[model samples]
Target chain A: MAVRLYAASVLALDDCLLSVMDIPGVLDALVMDHLSGTVMASGGRGEAERSAPALGETLRVTMDALAGATHRGTVRIDDLIVIADDGYHLLHPVEMPFDGPLVIYVRLDLGRANLALARHQLSSITGRLRG
Target chain B: MAAVHTLLTGLAREHATGSLNVPPAGKAYLREGRIAHLECPRTPSVERLLTAHGRAGGYSRAELEFCVAGAVLDAAYFLLPAELPAARPKFRPGECPRPDTRLEFELAWLVGECARRRAQLAQIWSSAELDDVPVTPAARLPGHRATVSALEWEILLSSDRVATPAELADRLGQPAYSVLLAVRRLAAAGLLVAPLMPRRRGRALDRAVPPALPQSDPNVLAAVKRALEELE
Candidate 1:
């Protein structure tokens, strides 16, 4: 599976601590950890080298606060799809088979991709990666 | 305690399918005598973990009652007695759609995971000094690994210098044993600091400081004095 290649790329990339390739590349691809909100890798960081760890910390705080506000005691990610000025950002967490829960993240350009197609592709990618 | 333990063990041996309530402590549901579900107030329940993981939602009182009944019957099938009894009784509870097989499997898996996690926590909690040692985040862990699970991250962040494994588990809504395992693993990996010795209870008394002992040579004179004192 091409997605498998992406997974391998993410794991393989020295700069990219984690990767989720072959996402519906509306803009580019992003690799994020759903739990920590850490951006382990990215394909397009045009004009900005955003701090991945900081972003991850922000996501964790946001999730925690949201859970607290809702009195849910836990936060479950349904799907994190956000439209930005440059492109579309999609966060898909891939569940690993082992004990350590790992997730794969992907980002893409809005003009270059279809939301439905990208989501479907990501879903398939996640399923294959998990299996 | 011996009698109760024996009874539970017997149920396990015979593969008796039923719910054994330990009054306020909790309940254990056995299917064909193998433990399928267990609830101990001291440990987080499987339902809580599933809900926390976003796999399931909190159940209403009625829904919980229904689930408890359903769980027992489903476990029975998995625990099908090696030898069928002479009279096979009919299941009375109006057949709810056979519980989603996948969900049932997941539930069982989660239950087992919780039990394992709880046992690990109990071991950590047993240590005297560590019993109340507050979990404090280590300033540094010797790892370059980029990403970890939410619970793992929480364990890293919330080890606030005092919360024990059980306390940390409660705070994070995770199985205590999981936190204990993570802590132990982190400690082994040189990620977390070892627990410090507990403070003495009595007040300090002023005394003349003793000279440092020589590293290379034994204190023959001091040893002779100690031996002479013992003999006298």
Candidate 2:
């Protein structure tokens, strides 16, 4: 029972976080369980454990605000970026099969980061995470 | 009951590998002491959720791992209550669930997380009554408009005005806890029909009224506008 079947279609997401860390000027990367606000995996210099729940709350508030401002029915937030004095915080929500969406949170160096490239990389990473 | 948590903790310390069967609730699978997976009848199992709701074709290891982790935590939340119905727990050594690349959690950390979830839900909604009742969308909005998350929207759409949160969870293949939270949030927002009617037990139900939204100050609105302009 220990030897599970080998299925090529099933790719590993273990490297996704490492890949995010490879992005230029990235300061931190975290995979967060948005529902419970738990940090599933993380890397880099930032305090991911402390920030996951706060970021989750931030995303929730942002979604609510945007929805209210738009007066639209059920708005879905694709990407959220917050600019701080020192750096940038990027959040992307990934839908999961079994539970609420998982959020991928990344912090980037303000002076060294390329915002466009970071966004593109985050999207690509999100695709893999969704898979 | 705390009984399950204590027993699992002891087994983890002993470095036991096998399944701990708590009849009626479910079973816990451990590998080399750490909890690998848990299945509860009251909640959706990872395998069932993955197979039933997973996108067509196979799943990525990340998806598998995420589902496994969520399902385990969810089951633990339901099974680790301080007091549960009376049931004898049996631990069978060297017995594990079918092989797969699964994520394991330390017994202590997992229990703590479950406790956090309980607190989180309690903080959101005071009662568990709505948890099992059919979710009913409010006939009229309390305000001109409201906001809801993707999952909340799903619940609203799937609701037949008859399916309880648990049933909706099963139908949608969502973690029961998540669905429960969404239902409570919807109720808090006045999106769901108020459950103010007294129950058969004669318990006075806390009126599910939406909290009044604070009046927006001009300065705050201006600041928000300025922030939005900057984002654009």
Scored by lDDT, the top model is 2
- CAPRI level of candidate 2: acceptable
The DockQ-based CAPRI class assigned to model 1 is incorrect
lDDT of each: 0.42, 0.70
Stretches of candidate 1 off by over 4 Å are: A1-131, B1-9, B22-26, B50-132, B139-150, B194-232
Q: After superposition, how far is residue B187 of candidate 2 from its true place, in Å?
A: 1.4
Native-to-model Cα distance after best TM-score fit, residue A50 in candidate 1, in Å: 43
Give lDDT: candidate 2, residue A5.
13
Question: For each predicted model, how many residue pairs clash, with residues at least 3 apart or on different chains?
Answer: 22, 0
Interface RMSD of 1: 15.7
lDDT of 1 by residue, B1-232 (tens): 1323334466667656656554333454545544444554444433333233332332222223222322332222212212222343232222222121111112233333334334544443433233335555556656663334355667878776755655565555454444655665455445556446432321111111212222221343333223222321
Cα error, residue B167 of model 2, in Å, equals 1.8
